[model samples]
Target: MKNLRVLDLTSCVDLLVTPKFSGCKNLAILILERCSQLVEVDHSIGDLKCLISLNLKFCTELSMLPVEMGHLTALKELLMDGTKVEEIPISIGQFKQLEGPIATLPDSVGELIRLNHLSVRDCHRIRKLPNSIGNIGISLVELDVSGTGVSKFPNSIKYLQKLKVLRMDSCFFKEFPPDIGELTSLEEIHASWCRSLEGGIPSEIGKLHNLRILRLRHSTISSIPMEIHQLSNLQTLDLLHCDMIKELPRLPSSIRELHVDDELKSSEIWILDNLRLQRLSTSKLPAMIKLSNLQTRRLLHCNTIKEVPKLPSGMMDLRVGDELKSSKIWNLHDLRLELLSTFIIQEEIQLSDPDLVDYFAAP
Candidate 1:
């Protein structure tokens, strides 16, 4: 099999140990996707110096990669999502074309000057990234480290001048590094669930001229810099559960989707002017209903909202909390009511509504 060029061993349910594929010296692509029972890749894999692509997606039972895997110098692409692999060997930095989701690369990973497109999603155990990662400079393209336990980004990240997309969702960073503005080529960023983040967002964030999407959900952010309005290319902004955020600056005219929490006060609602804005969530409906652009609005767990606000004639879908008084629902053209739990509706409402009979019937 030394001359074999492609080998796909995907979804082999009983496959436990890694197969001896190193004999395929000329192998260009090897895929082992959804092999849930796989435990480890054999060290002999290093002998496949001609391998270009390797995929190990959804191998939930996998624990680690072979330490000698770094010797596959000809490898170009690698994908390992939903695996238990804990540590990436430092020797991996020697691979000039390695790409894809890796939680923690070896400190020497900067040596892969030709590497591009790294995605490290749901790696909850990682605490930090290699400091030398910045050395890759303009060669790197996309970096996605969402759902990791990282608290801080390596300062070297600013050196990736060619980075286009950065997704750092659920990172526990208390604050973003000031140097983040240096990634001039960045186009999108997802930094949701950074609960401890404090201070206002850097005004310089608007400097990324190509930025299109910014997601900062479940963060402790108290205020957004007025400079945020400068992101002319911005299309979607998701700010769910930013409990301390007191107000919003005028949104960029290009924004189309805005998802916010239910607790925003009346004053904070004035800044929204997205003519195409479609999604909204709040504790109470506003007193002055003028949602000509609204398509979907969900009011969650707000007990005090006794009456639904007047919606625009164009409004299509409306979801209201269960606490509101029951009525023959004829007024709302496309209204959908989702009743809340007795505990969530309000502390005062003790009498359980018979419509809630479904809640107690759930398995």
Candidate 2:
């Protein structure tokens, strides 16, 4: 067993024992993914001096990791996603080469100077990061803390000079430390659901020229800084449920997907020109005289508009949350209407007109 190099026990639903793999002094990798019933890992696992990797993903019934895991000096990679493990042992920093998602690291985690990848998604109980987290300089490459309860990011994050991706979605941040713009090497960011955030986005954000994806959905932000257009490589901009936003800066031409709610005014509609817009939604249609190149539009909860307008020739899907009179709709193809009320339609007489048959066609 000393020669064991890899152990993969994924989806073994009823597994109940912590593997006694410490006997395999040469073990290099251990993978126990989706072992839902697994309850523990033996503390003696620290005896595997040559171990390089360990993965325990989606082991929901498991409650903790061996505190002695810190003694595995040769371990290089560790991954635990969707598990019930409560807190990361302080001894974790001893590994020197640890990687993957962490819930809450021991204050000693600062000692892991060689860590390169980390994701702490959905760890709702973690309120703050270790103050020493910033001292581990330049080694980390990816960090995602989305869906955690942490309200502020550790200033220590600025030390990760090699970081390529940082995702902090749903963390309830009221504002970010201004120095965040100093992470010049960052390539992507997901900061959705920061409901209390106010003021304009920091102008320094444009300095991350390498950024490719920015998701700020469900935030309270009312306007995007014109500097955002500097992200020449950005591909997706998701601003769903930003109810307070009234206008948008001209989007980057490189953007391929834009998902915004219908709270925008008519003047903002002109921003859609010359881009490959994919999904559009709003409470009311912009009063623009013409729309072309749009592919899909979903209108929700609009009380003012009485009819649909002449849409682009390539428009494929149109979903209306409320029914409109047949005559108010000028030309509709591939329409999907929901929650129609006869009383509402009768009040808007255009729908009952006999000539309406030429314009409305269901798909």
- Per-residue lDDT tens digits of candidate 2, residues 1-363? 777888889988889986677578788888899999999898778888787888888888877888788788887667777777767777777564333345566778677677776656676777777878776656877776777778887877777777788888888777754666788788888888888777657878788778877788888876677888888887778887877777777677667666666566556545554455444433345556245656555453444455566555455555454455455564533333332222233333333323333334333
Per-residue accuracy of model 1 over 1-363 as CA lDDT, tens digit each: 777998888999898987787577788888899999999888778888888888888899887888788888887667777777767777786564433345566778778788777656666676787888898886888887777777888888889999988878777888876776789888888888877788878888878878888888887877788878888888888887888887787778677667666566455464443345444444455555445565555444333455555554444444555665545222443332353222233334332334443443455
- On a 0 to 100 scale, what is the lDDT of residue 108 in model 2? 82
Candidate 1 Cα errors over 4 Å, as ranges = 8-22, 31-43, 55-67, 74-85, 94-103, 272-274, 278-363
Instruction: Provide the overall lDDT of each model, using Cα atoms, as 2-decimal numbers.
Output: 0.70, 0.69
- Candidate 2 ranges beyond 4 A from true positions: 7-22, 31-40, 55-64, 74-85, 94-103, 272-363
TM-score each candidate.
0.68, 0.67
lDDT of 2: 0.69
Residue pairs with backbone atoms closer than 3 Å in model 2 (clashes)? 134-156, 262-282, 262-283, 326-351
